[model samples]
Target: MVEERADAGLYGPDSVTWRIHGNQSMALAGFRALSLQAVHPLVMAGFNDNTVWFDDMWGRLQRTGDWVATVTYGTTAEAEKAGRVLRRIHAALPPGVEPESGLPYRVDDPELLRWVHVTETESFLSTYRRCGGILRPGEGDQYVDEMRASAELVGLERHTVPASEADIEDYYAYVRPQLRVSQVARRNTLKFMLPPMPRWVRLGTPARPAWAGMVGLGLAMLPPWARRLYGLPGLPTTDLLATANGYAVRRVLSTVPLVITSNPAYGRALRRTRGPVAA
Candidate 1:
C-alpha cells in the first residue's frame, strides 16, 4: 500500500474535490473522502453489464447531455455535512468538463477514475464487514467462500485462513506494485477507511436491474466448497484499522437525524397550469 501513492499527482481529483468542498477541516475532509469514495462506485457499477445501480446520475447525463448533478454525500446528517464538501467539488468544475459533458464523466477523466477505483475497494470491504455478510445477496457464508475462490484463482494462498500482519505486508508488496498505484497516492488515499452508512441504507425498494440478477445467479450457482476454497488473500489484523475507521463513520452517521425535503412552491404553480385531469 505504501508504494501506491508514490506520485504527488495521484490525488489531483481528491484534492480538487476537497478544495472545492472547502474540506479544510480534517473531520470534513475525512468524511468527504469517504462519501465520494462510496458515491464513485454506486454510479459506475450501474453502467457495467453485471451491476444494478449503473451510474444513474451519469446515465441521465448521457441521455440529456445536460448538467443535472445530484449531490448525495452522506446517508446521515453528519455525513450530509461532509457531503457538502463533495458538492462543492462537483460544482467547482471548469467549462467543457461539466458533469453533463458527453464523455463518460466518471470513467473518462483520470482523476475521477482513480477515485472510483479507490472507492470500489474501500466500500466493498467496508460494507462486507458492517453487514456481517447479510447485506449482500446470497447466504452469509457464501460471501467468504466466493472471496476465497477468487483469491485461489489468483494463485494466492493467504486467504486460506486468517492472515498475519507480515502476510498482509507481503501481499501488499506483491500486489500493490503490480497495480502500478503510485506510493504517494496509496499513502494519502489508503490512510483512512470510508465507513458504511450507519442505518439500513434503503432506497425505497427499487427494482433490481437485469444484469444484477445475472451476477447474482452466477454467484449462487457456484458450489459452496468451491467458493470457500477461493482465497481473498489478506491478513485480518492489517485490516483492523481500516475496518474500524469505516464503522466509525457509520456510527457517526447513525447519530444524525434523517433529513426530509419537499418540492418547491413553483412545482404547485406548474401543476395548476398543466391541469390534473387523469390519474
Candidate 2:
C-alpha cells in the first residue's frame, strides 16, 4: 500500500489543474474528450469488448466521473490505490481486436494509452480555457507537464505522452490520418450524448430546456475534426456559436452553490490541506 500524505494527491490547490478541473464546466470537457477518443478504432474496440458503456451510459459516466474526481482531489494513498486498481483491471482484460485492422490491442498498450491521455488532457484544457478558466501564460503547458505522472500511472510512457500545448497540437496533427468515424463512434455520439429525454423530464417542463441545452453544448464543444466525423457542421460560425454557448453555461454553473458542486473527495483534500479542526 502506498503511504498516505497530508498533501493533495498530484496537484495542490495552487496548481492550474486543480483550478481548471474543479470548475463544474469541465464536465463538458469530459464529454468532448469521450467523443474524441471514440474516433480511434482501437480505443473503441477496447471499450466495446470490455465495457457495458453502450448499454449503460449513465453508469459508465458516473464511474468515470468518480475516478477522475478521486485522482484529482484524493490524498496520495487514495490516488495511488485508485491507480493500482485501474492497472490491475486493465491487465486482466483480454486483448481487444480492432475491427478494421484485425490487429490485437491491449488495454495497457503504450500507444493506445498515449492516445487516451492526449485526447483527454487536450479536451479538458481546451474546454476549460474556452469556458473562461483563467490560466497564466504557460500555465496550460504546465498543466500538461503535471499530468505526465497521472498518465504514467495508467501505463503511458512519460516520453511518449505530449508534454506541452504545442506538443499536443502536433501530436493530434500527426495522428489525424489514423482517426476516422466508425459505426461504434456514430452510435455512441447519437445515443449516449443526445438520447431522448427520460419520461421524468417531460417535454414543456422547465427542466427540459436546460437538459436540451446541455446536450447541445456538448455536441458543439466537439473539436472540428470530430464534428465533421459525426457529420456536424464545422464552419467558423458554428465554432463561434459553440464558444458562446459554452461560455454561457460556464457563467451559469459558476454560480452553483459550493455545497452542491463540490465532490466529497475534494472536501477530504481540503480538510487535509487545512489540517484537523480543533475541538
Which candidate number maximizes TM-score?
2
Q: Give the distance in Å from residue 12's predicted Cα in candidate 1 to where it truly belongs.
A: 33
Off by over 4 Å in 2: 1-5, 194-198, 202-212, 276-279
lDDT of prediction 1: 0.30
lDDT of 2 by residue, 198-277 (tens): 77766556665665566667777877877887788988888888888888888887788878876767677777876643
Residues 1-279, candidate 1, lDDT per residue (tens digit)? 132321221112222221221111222222332333322322323223222222353353232211101111111232334335444544454323212223343323434433333332233333434423223342223322333322322223524421332332343344332222223222322322211222433233322232233222222222232122222123444245444544554455446553312212223323433453334
RMSD for all candidates, in order, please: 21.3, 3.6
Candidate 2 local Cα displacement, residue 54, angstroms:
3.8
Tell me how candidate 2 scores on lDDT: 0.81
TM-score of each: 0.26, 0.90
